[model samples]
Target: MSRNTFRQASLALSIATGLAALSLGAQAQVQEHSQAQRASAFSKAQGHIESFRGRSLSDADHSFEARDLVVDEDGAEHARFDRRYKGLKVLGGDLIVHSGRQGALQSLRQTLNRQLQIDTSPKLRAAEANRIALQQHGGELLSKQPELMIYARGDLPALAWDVRSFQTKADGTPSEMHIIVDAQNGRVLEAWDDIHTAAANGTGKTLYSGNVLLTTNSVSGGYELRDPSRGNTYTINMANRTSGGSILKDSDNSWGNNATSDSTSAATDAQFGTAVTWDYYKNVHGRMGIANDGKGAYNRVHYSRNYNNAYWSDSCFCMTYGDGDGTSLRPLVSLDVAGHEMTHGVTSRTANLTYSGESGGLNEATSDIFGTMVEFYAANANDSGDYLIGEKIMIGRSFMRSMIKPSADGASADCWYAGVGNLDVHYSSGVANHLFFILAEGTNSPLGASPTCVAGNTRVATGNASLSGIGRTAAAKIWYRALTTKMTSATNYAGARAATLAAAAELTATLGSDYSAQVAAAWSAVGVN
Candidate 1:
């Protein structure tokens, strides 16, 4: 059990024991104290409860002080607060304070502090407040221990805290702890322990710290290898999600209690590319990092032994990429590849389009579009704004999925016309990618229209089906709007058509676009409209 858990359980047990003792025989319990001691605490506790039976606001502010009140039957003076509540009268302790809105809470806290005796109000030491929470509801605390609670003063959120699910490194260990703190008053509110574990341990959830085996060499900054000469390994340095900014240091990259080796060149490439991708999203879209919720996750490069794929796991809340057959070819850490995988996170948070059928295809297309945009956004001359997918990371004889011509990657369908969903997401995304290219460059000569692959997924007659190129600027705006607003749980090509229209209309409402028609034609070119 964690320290907080033990603490909360302790408080609850104590409260129960106290209540049971009080009910057993009031006179015997306070036999050493005065009659005043026998009367007030229990009576006051009862009053506090009754007052909370959903009263109104106008009648809520209740304050009082009982003189020489028998705190323990010796007539010891303990402060008293009576809430003749309008809404909830029996409100006390942490939850009551945190649950209140910001403005009213300030008033309420002051009211509580003034009404209750300052000495008896549970003034926790700053160190104790570090992770202890004390909660009293209906005049009874929850844990057996009165001193320490599950809610130590932190984790209180602004009125906008969203309830989230968290998993932990397998071992049946809890991943997240619930502690409610008053944002306004900075007081402990209420908290609960999240009980979950890692997958590898069966009882616990495995936290895969994407650190792959690495070999140290004087040259190439030491690359990642499965069985390098010196048994070296490097871990994917995780980007801190809860905290803001970046921590670039030796301690940050230390993997598995071992010294850092920079992992594979691909890992370094992927990490750097993702960092760039993160910066691009923030710069262009004004997004709050990755999830647009002011949160960004880390990328684990060199994921398994010779693993040849990349995927995002919602359960882990992170992305994992495999090295190319444990060789130099398929590096997921490539620039476009990094952008591609990172975009999956954005799609998950926004559209949440499922990974099957047409929605899957659209989802893949969304990734490709954003991935390409990130590449261009960075203006990295080494990796220009091209329709090609994985130019640097060679898979087989060619790069991973080719957007210019899906068939070039030995998979994807170059243009959308129907039956796009029948293929893989990477290939199926061609239609949308083509449309994006059109939106950016218009019909005559598309921007970065490298070489076209066999348009076999839907139609093979490929001769530069020039969309009334609305330009990538317009395409990006339409995509952002559609993903954020118009899309839902199962977004597909048809959905994309409608969403883009709606997005265009919204844009038209604001920007007054002759550009919307251009967007429509681009969508129509690929069969969305």
Candidate 2:
């Protein structure tokens, strides 16, 4: 609900047609306009329409069929002709005139466009708009709790545009209606609605709650889980930590190093990124905050100017974003960035791997794995995406990080080897990214897996640890369990192997019975064993 403002604005004048040009005839009209009985009836009707623009009319009041009506000095308009839909808000009343829809609608669009100063008609009606807003809004919800914003979306489906909005429903998830609305005009131009149609024969719900978001804390921006007893394993806390300062401050007592950077845009990026990501995670994932136990984490965005990267500092338990060159080449602080950065939080919560050598590689891999998953789930427009990373924040459409082809980044490797962890954290991430990519998707033999890693084991540690390929989906599931259930402080590749096996074992217990062979096979495919 929004407050109504009473302001005097002139209504665009239009000449009345036929009887609209005549004087009042009915006694009701004459009695109301006793002093102006000789005036044109159209003039009386216009006055009635103008009277109720900004003010609310009684549900029983049926006055005139106000059309092309403009608000008067009181900023109110009254609609009494259509009592059938009078109680309906926003779309209520008989203001709709189909005959003049073309001109009036076009003019209304023009009016709103001029008022909001926006073009391309992205006004909640465009397909991409829904995507971006979701990235910014829903994505934030999810960062806090993966289960909160439980993604009912798949690799996002293309949105179809309607008259005032883009509308459509995704393929798999029966929980949501993909929609963008022109808030100004109360029109839906783009929509992926989940409302089941008797004819289309569909049934589903869009979200747990469409209007409200639950926060864990009373903190100005923090959000809590809606249901504390859900399958959450941690109490997740979300802080709009958009800078090193904020990140350092957020997790003062947490068990992680603070990733520090001096980038200027880092703070801003982090702030927005954190808000949206946390919300996305919280709403979609249905978990508490990042830790899932309701512990609040801080975020810091703009640390320094001209800085070109973003990172999650485990030591500090905070996330930071950077401004990369003038083009905003910063790494991880976008909707996907937030999702990726915080997935590190999720990984840390679950995996707790060391940030160096094999463990460090595992940590990086964990971030990329969930990060990509979050992106697919979000289905946002500003970042409606692929498995690519840093698409918008970095080099235009190019991905700064790629699990399928780590070499594409010229920094990360596509597959893990015995000594791959010896590299820097950024580079060490290549192996896990590769592992995740394969785990989520599949082998490169299909030609779509970006074959830049043609060098094979050349990027691996100097060992004969050659790896085959495990399908991406199986790999991701195994890793998710490993990080969330069995990982410990002394985590290493061997530890990861053991923990993941245990996680796999535990998963199999609930799922069926046997996953030992598959888990072992997956690890070998990533060259882990």
lDDT of 1 by residue, 1-529 (tens): 0111110011111110121112113323333444544254435433443354332122234333221121211222222232332122222211111111111211111111212211122344433333333222111123322322222112221211112223332222224433443333445454333221111110000111122222211212322211111111122533312223221222122223211233434444544455556656655564544554333465565544454555555545555655545354454555566677677777766555555456667777787788888777756544566766666556345555555555555555656655666665555666677666667765556444533223344543256554555557667877876676556534567767877876686566444575667777666655555
Note the Cα lDDT for every prediction shown: 0.45, 0.41
Error of 1 at 42 (Å): 42
* Model 1 backbone overlap count: 54
C-alpha TM-scores of all predictions: 0.50, 0.45
**How does candidate 1 score on lDDT?**
0.45
Each prediction's Cα RMSD? 22.7, 27.3
Across residues 1-529, which tens digit of lDDT does each residue of candidate 2 receive? Answer: 1112212111111111111111113323423442232133335444433444333232332243322221212222211122122222121122311112122211100000101111222233334444444643242111221110111111221122222222222321112333333433433333322221100000000111011111111122332221111111112212322222322112111111112232222333343344445544444433345765444466544434444555555555655444345553533455566667777777555434445456566666676666666665544444554676656565554666766667776666555656675676667777666655544454543524433233346663222333344444445566765564345323556667676676566456444555666556545555566
Quantify how close model 2 is to the true structure by its C-alpha RMSD in Å.
27.3
The 10-residue segment of model 2 with minimum total lDDT is: 197-206
